[model samples]
Target: MAENTAERIDWRQLWASGDLARFCFICLGILLHATNETMVATVMPAMVGDLSGVELVGWSLAVYEIGAIVAGAAAGRMTSYVALRTNMMGAALVYSAGALLCATAPSMPAFLAGRLVEGFGGGALVSLAFVSVERLFPQRIWPQLFGVISAVWGVAAFSGPLIGALMSEFLSWRWAFGVFAAGGVAAALACLAVLRGPAATRQRNDGAPLPPFPFATLACLAVSVVLIASAGVDVTPLRSSLLLAAGLFGIALFFGLDRRLPAGRLFPAKPLSLATPLGNGMIMVAAFSVATVTFTVYGPLLLTSLHGTSVLTTGYIIAAESIAWSVLSILVANTPPERERGIVLAGALMIAGGVAGFAYAVPAGNIPLILGCAILQGGGFGIAWPFVTRIIVTAAPAAERTVASSAVPTMQRIGYAVGAASCGIVANASGFAGGLSSQTAAGVAAWLFLAFLPLGVLGCLAAWRLPANSASPAPA
Candidate 1:
């Protein structure tokens, strides 16, 4: 069968639609979040160089995602009462303010506060962007739309890391955050100008009234992440273990409560199980996402310490994955539905391979091998992500499409949040907190890089469960 209606959909019409301006802003919202993530990674080594809390390196990422998870959970519910344009405008402004806070932070603890705030605004922007896609665009081109969304990261890959590298290498890293802060403000202004009409200002009744916001469910996730993240920051083996166990319970409680929500449920039914299509797809995203944080949260420090790579070089090296992902997603956006299953399985294997390669290549200090693995890991995700997403949204119950769409990124962030905390624990245990000597750096490289390999295996196992029958498009 034809793939996701893209072959029959008009590519030009998407750009020509009257909604183009809204669409552009949507992309801008995505750009802010994507750039902020990679840019921070590029600048992290420098941030630590000038500051303390090397042991808390993972907390930087953890706090950001924690903020994101909260905002993302609330974003869908916000749409029931808040206008899309208004929600977006408020979110963009908040994002800018948070960046400004980060840019001026005086110490590590202070900087983390900024990251948390920035994450809230950025997360809402992204989740709202997905809701906007469904609300504004023709259903015919959803696959194509997702392909373009994937390309946004590639754009960020070039711009975000470069800005970060430049700031870290030449000027102060604070300048990088300053530039993005300005970008966020610009996006907020565009929302006012482009979405001016009375029709755009009102809440859109896209479907039946959504349920009341799931406060109990949201609390479970918040508590879970806090306990898990706190466990690693001051790592005593016994205390950390206890916290980790408590955090896992939070996740369990979240799943239990979220499942019971009548209409305002955070996910489709059976979100955690692999039996249902939505669950299986979410599992795949979560596993691979958890498996990949080594590069983002820890890649720069290890590269600089092990090989004497400049910040710019490390940024570019990590940026390679983004490049590959964008190219592959664009290249394969139209694969017939029949082939999607095989592609998913193959891509899962490739992702695991690249992650495994990192454990060896990082410790060995081989530049070519490291770059090659990065490309493989990125390309694997690019190749598989759209199809995985398509399977998910396509399989969603007609009434719950919005929830399913927003859940896509929310699920991915959950993986990153858990992964970041796990990284702090492993890295600290490996003696990185004592500061890295060449000998210790190599050992940390081995442990840190290998830590998430099991997540890769788990993702591959989930990939095997993807239905062989082709799924259909979601309701328009």
Candidate 2:
């Protein structure tokens, strides 16, 4: 199948004839997930103030991501066994319940529980959204459809924090949670209305029992994340180092156990090997994700402390990255086949330049330069992501297409989780653990971004290695 449809298909005609209602519902799943993430991020400070859980604040994000990672990994297989509509509706309901829990929680522990549940649902929503694209759309429209989804994320980037801030300031942070719950309920109903029948499932039953859940691997992965997250707290240096090491060991063990599993493996064959296109593309995704985590996780704090920027301005600056991504993705979604490899390589370079730009601009308190760098960084991902995703999905064996589709976002999330932890270690080592004074904040901002430079370089190398023709058949 030709991955590039620009030469043959009219995008306008495709949209005119396509099921817009179903597409909108599909996009809604991811929109809600993305919006809720930024909203929670915006409102967290207020939540902490009310709940009095300053010390346990980090765990809120940690637990949510841990749940997301696990649920995202499982979602592909789950869809194979259950109807897509059923899975999506159930996920939306779970999300709604979690939001209600958050709105009513009086203590930090209760709030953490809600976040975990919310993470699981949000993770499933995102992964399943990709799967829906595969199942619902013709191959020719895949890139354009992905472009639309990217645009939705761009919209969320602007609105999520605004809604969160508004709720936090006037209506109370709890109302923010209530609002998300309402969105989830609406999304659930949309899923019920739009998705129909067994055709939405990944595979038809052939009288074989459903495979056992990958419980052992999931447990290992979850524990690994928890350990790494714990290292970020005010622990002793020796203890933190030990925790990180242990966490890495657990991750290694997970790969080994997953490889041996007879069924329901988390990834495709030789998924970690760089020899295959799928593996290489995934590595590129993960490496770039790790490299960018410094900005998403710490940009607001560093910008506010060093540059004296308002919270809202810092957020929009950070959001410039997503805006750039959406714009660039829409521009190149239908690039001619011959131009893709060049675009991918160029995008990777742009990302690396953006990271380097941040290393200088952020610490120096140059807001215009910082914003410009953000656009470059986001634009880089925007340019390359659709192509990278299409390549990875097409290269997977037919039986594993669902897994491959989910794995892209799953890997990105895992990268974020791991990168956040690694940054925590670096921050502690560089005097950020003591709290951010102007001097300490400047030093931390520089080193934090500089630390990820090598990862970005690795991503560039991986992008270079991607096969020139992305539409080649999956390797046996």
Shift in Å, residue 381, candidate 1? 0.8
> TM-score per candidate, in order?
0.90, 0.83
- Deviation (Å) of 474 in candidate 1: 12
Q: What overall lDDT, based on C-alpha atoms, would model 1 receive against the true structure? A: 0.83
Give model 2 RMSD, 1 decimal: 4.3
The clash number for model 2 is 0
Per-residue CA lDDT of model 2 for 185-213, tens digit only, reads: 99899998877745674454567777778
In model 2, which runs have C-alpha deviations exceeding 4 angstroms?
1-19, 44-61, 76-86, 103-110, 127-151, 165-173, 189-206, 393-402, 435-443, 468-475
Error in Å for residue 111 of model 2: 3.9
Clashes of 1: 0
Worst 10 residues of 2 by lDDT: 52-61
